[model samples]
Target: MTLEQLKIGQRCKVKKVLAQGMLKRKLLEMGITPGAEILFRKVAPLGDPIQISLRGYELSIRKVDAKNISVEIID
Candidate 1:
């Protein structure tokens, strides 16, 4: 599954990121790397920006970008 598909309250591990160039670098800079554990916190009312907890902090990301992040459910 992808980050975009992770349900709220679910925990997942990063499998891979399907982004390229600047986007990939940006994600990496934000600490989204393989083997990273992530918790799906919440999403906007309209589901545009999604809030996730990872690496000791919360990050809000767009669904479009989230789809580029591949993840697998951990719990």
Candidate 2:
């Protein structure tokens, strides 16, 4: 499944990052890499940006960008 499809409170591991070039690099630099665990935290009312917790930090990502990340549900 894709990161964008995960429900709030779900936990998953990143399988792949489909983004290219700078976008991919930025995500990697921010600690989003294959095998990393991610927790779906919150979403804005409009659902444009998504909040996730990973590596002991919380990060907000745009829905469009979150779609580029592939993940597998943990539980």
Candidate 3:
């Protein structure tokens, strides 16, 4: 499933990031890589950006970008 599909407070393992061009590079630079563990923290008030904890930090990734990230839901 995609990161955008994960529910809030859910934990998932990043399977792969399907983003391309600068977006992909940006995500990589932010520590979002394949096999990384991600925990969905909360969605923005408007649901555009979703807060997630990854690589020991919290990141606010937009839904559009989240769609490019695939993850396997975990406990």
Best by lDDT: 2
Candidate 1: stretches off by over 4 Å: none
Record all residue pairs in model 3 with backbone atoms less than 3 Å apart, i.e. clashing.
Answer: none
Model 2 lDDT, full chain set: 0.94
Q: Which ten residues in a row have the lowest lDDT in candidate 3?
A: 27-36
lDDT of each residue in 1-75, candidate 1, tens digit only: 899897899999999989999989999899999999999999999968999999999999999999999999996
Q: What TM-score does candidate 1 reach?
A: 0.96
Task: Tell me the spans in candidate 2 whose CA falls farther than 4 Å from its real position.
Answer: none
Error of 2 at 7 (Å): 0.4
Model 3: number of backbone collisions: 0
lDDT of 2 at 5: 95
Q: Sorted on lDDT, highest at the top, how do the candidates line up?
A: 2, 1, 3
lDDT tens string, model 3, 1-75?
899888889999988989899999998889889989999999999868999999899999889889999899987
Candidate 2, residues 29-51: lDDT per residue as tens digits?
A: 99999999999999989976999
Candidate order, TM-score descending: 2, 1, 3
Backbone clash numbers for all candidates listed = 0, 0, 0
TM-score of each: 0.96, 0.96, 0.94
Total clashes in model 1, counting residue pairs 3 or more apart in sequence or in different chains: 0
